[model samples]
Target chain A: DVKVTQSSRYLVKRTGEKVFLECVQDMDHENMFWYRQDPGLGLRLIYFSYDVKMKEKGDIPEGYSVSREKKERFSLILESASTNQTSMYLCASSSPSEAFFGQGTRLTVV
Target chain B: DQQVKQNSPSLSVQEGRISILNCDYTNSMFDYFLWYKKYPAEGPTFLISISSIKDKNEDGRFTVFLNKSAKHLSLHIVPSQPGDSAVYFCAASDIVSGNQFYFGTGTSLTVIP
Candidate 1:
């Protein structure tokens, strides 16, 4: 079975605190993506990595960054948590046909 | 600007009835399209996909229809069950543009039992 695991199911952080959301996929897929889902905005891509040690910004990458040091692991970083950053974060690994997603992480910033 | 868009924010359908979700894209470079179903607090799951080369693809009760000339696509769910209630997102990708998937705003679907 294809599996993508996210580190946290829910998290709460204070403003100015740094946050890290980790994801790992057993499929060893070449592409990994981090996205945040908002109520009306849908799923907007934050960052994506096509290969290890490589990262590309998505539509909304203002307050976030990503790292992919290893092939199976991709990490999303919140430089400093802010109230506007509170949302559900999703991670996905994609092959040529489809992308398998992790459960998701709901982050609340206060 | 949103390259892909789901104009409908919500749709309520009775059980055993057909549910249709629509999506439109502005970019002509997009050659591949996909539909994903998402539940509350869960990540979206792949439902179906269609390529530009093909106009339609079916899997079980889900069928995706693509109209290249209109830059539109729709997903049809036959005999939708209550379990089918969720948000549906349409995504598009341009193979030439790093194959990064672009998603629409999403349509919330509710199948009443």
Candidate 2:
């Protein structure tokens, strides 16, 4: 089955620490996205990569960055973890039809 | 501002009843719209999608209706079961604009048995 796998299901980090969330897709989709889901804000896109090494800022990319070094993997990086950055982060890869998501990584920055 | 909006935060329905989740978007350039179902602690999964060319699309128990003129879309679940209870999200994207997909706030649906 086609799959998008997230490296960690849950994480807790100290404030000011650099954090990394890894995602990999076996479907070879060209489009990969990173989003954080908050209560009332829903899923706000942080960053996305359309091709290897090509990234674009999304609606809420201020506190996050992404790396797409290889075709099957996309990584979300938090330069410095903060309490406000604690949220459910989701990774997705898409083709022309639809997007497939990873199980998600719930990160807690304290 | 949120380009896509799901006004309802939550909805409850009895078993074997119809459940309707609504979404509206401000972008007219969006040519593809989709619905996703998410359970607690899980990533949202693709449910159904409707292209701008078609007004409606059905897949078994789920159907998505799109009205381009109004920039509105709705998902209908007939005879919703308890297993159907989950958070639903609506998303829209215009391939011409880019590969980015805009999502709504989401509606949490509960189907009581």
**Which candidate number maximizes DockQ?**
2
Residue-wise C-alpha lDDT for candidate 2, range B54-110, written one tens digit per residue: 999999999999999999999999989999999999999996665888899999999
lDDT of 1 at A21: 100
TM per candidate comes to 0.96, 0.97
lDDT of 1 by residue, B1-113 (tens): 89999999999999999999999999998999999999999999999999999999999999999999999999999989999999999999886565578899999999999
**Clashes in candidate 1: how many?**
0
Best by TM-score, which number? 2
Q: TM-score, B chain, candidate 2?
A: 0.98
DockQ of 1: 0.69
How many clashing residue pairs appear in each of the predictions shown? Answer: 0, 0
lDDT of model number 1: 0.95
Locate the minimum summed-lDDT window of 10 residues in model 1 chain A.
Answer: A92-101
TM-score of 1: 0.96
Chain A TM-score of each candidate structure, as shown? 0.98, 0.98
> Ten consecutive residues with minimal summed lDDT in candidate 1 chain B?
B93-102
Regions of model 2 farther than 4 Å from truth: none
